[model samples]
Target: MNSKHQILVIGAGTGGLMMASRLKKEHKDFDIAIIDPAKTHYYQPAWTLVGAGTYDFEDTAKPMADLIPKGVKWYQDKVTAMDPDSNSVSTEKSGEIKYDYLVVSPGLTYDMSLVPGLSEAIDKGNVCSNYTDPKHTLEVLKNFKGGTALFTQPTTPIKCGGAPQKIMYLAEAYFKKHGLKDKTNVVFATNGTVIFAVPEIKETLMKIVDRKNINLKFYHALKRIDAEKQIAWYELAPEAYEHNPAKLEIEKEGNMVGIHYDMLHLAPPSVAPEFVRKSKLANAEGWLDVDHHSLQHNKYPNVFGLGDVAALPTAKTGAAIRKQVPVVLDNIEKLMKNQAADNKKYNGYSSCPLVTEYGKMVLAEFDYDNKFTPDPELKKMLIFDSSKEHWRLWILKKYGLPYLYWNKMLKGQDV
Candidate 1:
């Protein structure tokens, strides 16, 4: 009910929740309030396995009420408009709230409707996307039998770039397990020219694709889906125009082609929310305009952001948020004390446990410069191999991660 607070955190997702919980633990004087419309908190990383039938959907989600940090004010309302200059944000249910400091981490929006016939295909069976709601995952997987199953990644920046292919790999493993490998054809259709960003990882992925006999289609963008005919239309690059062959040249540039598919797994385009997108604080790419080092708003000093919505030029994942939480908290604490904070920079450290199969994963850890930051210490401490396809990594992903996320990361307990 109070409209004023020392700090207002928009969204109760990983970033927002982490920031609020950390701030509450560090500074008792500051009144912290969190606004979110959702009633559940999902460990989104687990959805890949859920789609693959490896993990139960129920295990990936938890009640929002139980997750909110103790003593912090919780407002279950959607943010309608955010006015950075006035230090106020309006909500759908609760009119307006004013704050001394604001943290925007509402997360990105998944625009599935942008793809033609995608909605119908998903409803009609034969198409599923693990990047969205988990309820439909089981239905889609159950219907998949023996046919050309296509997995696609959009050109736009996504929350977890590796996630699209992770599910594909899982499906490939599932087909093999169920004795349908020979009958079914698996394909990864991506706009990117390479499988993985890191050269080391890409090399491994290429071997896996070849060994498994999975078709890899690059520079092909998903155009439309004909669910009825089970035909997915894709425009290949280097498309030539008949009217002006010499003057116009090739539009697609040797990359124009089309392919039909029996089944499709679509990854929708993602972007910052309209409120954040339209705001001046957003970058040209429509992400929170923040210093990559400070995680503070480039324009508004009192505002800060992290996680998927931030304009940090790195893969958006919860692992990135784990490293960012402390930096943001320290900076905010120092600012509140009217003291200059030490420039503790974040090197865009993000991890993607690339699950190549049900029991295998390539723990890809890298920073902003695309350099490996392997946790050899973790391997030594746990007494396990850090290589791809280890049961230890699988257990870490299945049980260890969710526990760490809830008890440590969200609670602001530094490990």
Candidate 2:
């Protein structure tokens, strides 16, 4: 095997695979290689549906072997260290690899330790998370005995910001189906003040929150969980703490409070992978330090990043990866040819299909400024109003996006 290559991709997840495939389609003869130890590549967007028991868990995964682009050498090994200054990467199995350009997209790591007792609580049936295991989530929903079901969002950045609530909405629908709606006390506890960032979708979700009679606890972040005792602990946000204490009840240990629950669904705290987090390449927030517009490293011109790992101020989602792919590829091509780069710039575009109910979704698409930027293809054709809940968007979320991911994006079609 060659020690040096024209391009080296660090992770074979959505971003790396898409970038490699696109590069392959454009430059068939380019010396490209991808390093990853994963045997299976998962279509993570469908996990929500899987958790809701609407989609099969098996359908969300594919062998990594089947997805790698033709002629792109695959190193099935985990990366240990990156020496960008020496233009080389060190892997566990393959000692050293040199590259003219590097692409880092290992994605985030789940920090189960962020919330005390989270690791031990997840296996206890009553506490399940859709973020990690969709099957467990289904099991939890099926075995629900009906009481106060608590859905929580952590304070840290998470992939698919709408996911914490998406499953809750699905659980609500499930309760209605099984005649448990009356007995179920549905509560959504999140640290964020608003239900959603986009105004149009937030307005729509507010209506759903009211109509469904779901409890909305704003400025409440999950602090810990006593799974054995069926107690979920929370700490009030700074704003809430600063507000009049006359109305709010404070616990003896400061602003802590507890909610008794029959079932607890939590969104685990997410952070950059340990390898990336400990590296000098990472920013203050422990994410890849890259220019938001060009997708290039702020310090090193040869380094590029995208997807969940990059410090781009956008909601991390597969839809966001689709938008980031083109910009990274364009810049890489220019840099490879020794031409002045920066022609293509990413606009911080990300889309989150907020599944409000069964067969209904509000496709929230936006840019850096949090302004609604609907897909031009759908917007021009007037297929559906993305900001409103529609069955068409739900179909796209269920069927269309997965098809596009496997057949188009990873195959280098760029659409």
Tally clashes: model 1.
11
lDDT of each: 0.79, 0.87
Q: Candidate 2 at 128: error in angstroms?
A: 1.0
* Candidate 1 global TM-score: 0.92
lDDT per residue, candidate 1, 335-383, as tens digits? Answer: 8889764556888999888888778777778889877677775665462
| Off by more than 4 A, model 1 | 238-256, 341-344, 381-387
lDDT of 1: 0.79
Model 1 lDDT at residue 344? 64
Clashing pairs in 2: none
